[model samples]
Target: MKILYLSLRFPYPPFSGDKIRTYNILKHLSYKHSISFVSFMLSPDEKNQINKLQEFCKEVEIVEFSKLKAYSNCIIRSYSGEPFQISYWYSPEMQKKVDNLMEKDGFDLVHVQFFRMAQYIKKYTDRRKILDSGDSFWLNLSRRSKLDRGIVWPLLKLEASKVRIYETEIAKWFDQVTMVSPLDMQCLLSNDSNLPISVVPMGVDLDYFQPGSKSDDLNLLFTGTIRYFPNKDAILYFYNEIFPLIKESVPNVKFYVVGNSPPKNIQNLASNGDIVVTGRVEDVRPYFDNSAVFVCPLRSGSGMQAKILEAMAMGVPVVTTSMGVTAFDAFIDKDIMVADDPKLFANKVIQLLKDRELRQNIALNARHLVEEKYGWSSIVDRFDKIYENALANRS
Candidate 1:
């Protein structure tokens, strides 16, 4: 199949969840299908990475999006009904590129990566489009509104409303739409009942993340791009609400907040000794292997937590909130420890820290779950089927 894959960002380096998910799926699909990619490059460095992607994609086209231009567009559209996020990515150059490609070579299917890029293809409803929503953007925005406060709160609330309006209307333009988790799909269906939605889970590389032979001391780790609101909030929640409680019992225990672009608050937490914030490492598997527990205390976010899956695939025991476990179908006691409250979360982490047998059992179960369900090969196969279905329906 001649597939046109449209991405909101360049899926290179595969460091973060969004990029990793898109890159792995495209890598797998490239084996059985020919893919031509058109995506926005955030930096000049990303342009050089396009050569690396050429190994998988038959053709790759990346358009650099200037921060100044995107922000200006957002301000211009903020006055109107459109979501700032959608407007931020709006570029005539991208539309022109897509138009030029479609006019020159006919594609069997067009796979739009995220909601931000959905605007470019909404008018091209005549062609088969498989919209990968990634997550329900409206739902995420609405959740954010409740968490944000004061003046920023009203802005978030307004943006959330705009996102819902856009989502409901733009969804009608795609042949089919998919999200990372069943929970996200349900949220989308509830908001827009008529849209055809499916679940294509985020995948992990099990080989690189498999269980280690030895276990380290009771060290708790939380990994993500700390610049993101949900991740920053999660770490803040851990440091402020949960870690203090855990410290009373496990005085020697260490907490590592590992990721890129950590805020000053997170950096300050690192100064207090027990908490260490390693901003962006070349690899995260070693940290996962060395840690006694992986905790994701996410209060607000949509879709699956890829870090949880990565840790699970590494055979590391995990303790997370109900929000952290969002779209995954794994059993709580069998695969992980699920806790919504800070005290209970701290208790669970402490329990796993002391009980080696329990930790090993949960880690083994979690690894089994990922290998069977969340492995890259299996997840991408589902995407291939969805693409085939979209093309078949179009014909």
Candidate 2:
């Protein structure tokens, strides 16, 4: 099969949410399908990985996007009645390339990675179009608005409102659309009952994140790209509302905030010995191994938590909210322990720290869960079926 894969960002290094999903899917699907990638890149550093991607992709086109230009576009089109994301990524050059590709290549499918890129491909009816919206952007923005500041809050709400209308409107045009979690699929269905939506979840590299020897340090861990709204909110909520309660019970308890590009506020958290923020580490497996419990107290997010899956895959006991585990079909207290309340979340962590047997059981079950249901090969096979179904329904 031949696929024209459209990405908002060039998927390399696969560190962040959008990049991870796109890169993994390309790697897996490219083995069997001829994938031609068209995307944008911000930094020259990102181009280093083009060679790696070109190994699988038949052709790779990287559009140069600048921070200044993106912001300029954002302000210029804020009144265009479309979401800011859509405006920022709109490029006539890239659109011409896509239009030419469809005319010349005669690809089997047009696979777009996000709604931001949807504006470019939504009108392309010449091929079987599959929109892979990894998560519910509107739902996510709505949650972010709840915790946003005065002026920014209203802007976020406006964006969310626009996305709700935009996503539902565009859903009718695509042959099929995909989300990473069932909750997100529900969000899309709520918009349009008849829209075809499928759940193709984020997968973990099982062999890379295998079980390690548990450490004696009473360290609690949470890992994600620290600058992201979902992750930033989660760590702040944990530090301010939850960690103090745990500290009262277990005085020596330490929390490790692991991942990349933490802001000053997040970095300031490291001033106190209780919270240790590693801005950007090459690997996070050590944090998982040393942790007595992994906590994901995300206040607002619409899809699966990759950090939760990665820790669980590394055989780390996880304690997270109802929102945290919503994506996975994992059983509560069976595969992992769950609590929404700050006090309750702390108690779960303390309990796990004290009860080594229960901790190990959760870790073991979590590892088993991902191994069976969340590997890349298994997920790509599912995508294969969805592609076939989309083509079959194509008019």
Candidate 3:
């Protein structure tokens, strides 16, 4: 099959959730399908990494995006019905590039990475198209609107409303739609139950994140793009409400916040060194290698948390909230430890920290579960089938 793949960002480095999904899909699908990749790049440095993706894509095109201009576009269209995200990513040059490619390449199907990029192909009805909405933006914004306080909450509510309507209508333009989990699928259904949506679970690079020698130091780790609201909230919530409780029982326990681009507030938490904020590391496996437990205390977010899967794949015991495990199938107390309340969350972490035998059992169970279900090799086959089915129906 010849596929025209569109992404909001170039899938190189593969650090973030969307990039990881896109990069792996390209790698696995490229063997069976010829893919021509077109994506937006936020920095000039990204162009240098095209060679990495050339390994998977037959042809690659990267469109340079201006952050300043995108923000101006959003500000100009703020009063319009378009969602902030949709407006921010709108580029006339990108539209022109996609149009030229569609005209030149007789592709089998056009696979769009996110709804934000769906703008370029929504009008093309001559071919099969798949919109991977990733996580329902409406669900993510709605959760943020409620959990957030101050002036930004109103804007969040407004964006959520716009995204709910726009996302519902856009899915109708595609032949089929896909998301990371059932919870995200449900979010779209809540708006319009008739939209065609499928769940494709996220996966981890098992070889890259395999378990290593654990350090003797008691460490609790949370990893993600810290500047993201959900992650920012999770870290703050842990430090303010939960970390103190854990410290009472285990005074020497340390927390590590690993990821790129942490905001000022998050940076402040590392002042005394109880929390080590490694802004951006070349690799994350080292953090997972040294940690005894992985904590994902997300209060507001959509879709499955990839960080949790990576930690689980690395044979690290996980303590997370119900929100953290949504759409993830794992037995509590056996595969992982779950708690929502601050005290209970703290206790769960403390238990995992002190009891080496229990931690080992949970870690082993979690790793086995990941190997059985969440490996990318198994997950990408589902995409292959989706493409085949879509093309079959086209006939």
Q: Point to the candidate with the largest lDDT.
A: 3
Find the 10 residues in a row with the least total lDDT in model 3.
382-391
Model 2, position 298, has a per-residue lDDT of: 84
C-alpha displacement of 184 in model 1, angstroms? Answer: 1.1
* Candidate 2: residue 60 Cα off by (Å): 1.7
lDDT of 1 by residue, 170-248 (tens): 7778888888988788877887787898889888998877787655677899999998999988888888999999999
Q: Which digits, one per residue and each the tens of the lDDT, describe model 2 over residues 1-395?
A: 99999998887887777787888889899889999999987789878879979988999988788777778888998888988888878887878888888788988888988888877887776668888888998999998898877678888988899999888888777888899999999998998899989899989888889999989899999888999988999999999999999999899999999989888999998988789998888888988999999999988978888888888899998999988889998999999888998989989998998888998899999999999999888988888999999888764
Could you say which candidate leads in TM-score? 3
The sequence of per-residue lDDT tens digits that candidate 3 reaches over residues 1-395 is 89999999988889889999999989988989999999999888899999999988999998999999899999998888899999999999999999999999899899999999999998898789999889988999888888898799888988888999999999999888999999899889888898988999999989888989989889999999999999999999999999999999999999999999999999998997799999989999999989999999999989888999999999999999999988688999999999999999999999999999999999999999999999999999988888888888889
Superposition TM-score, candidate 1 onto the true structure: 0.98
Instruction: Enumerate residue pairs that collide in model 2.
Output: none
lDDT score, candidate 2, position 306 = 81
- lDDT score, residue 233, model 1? 86
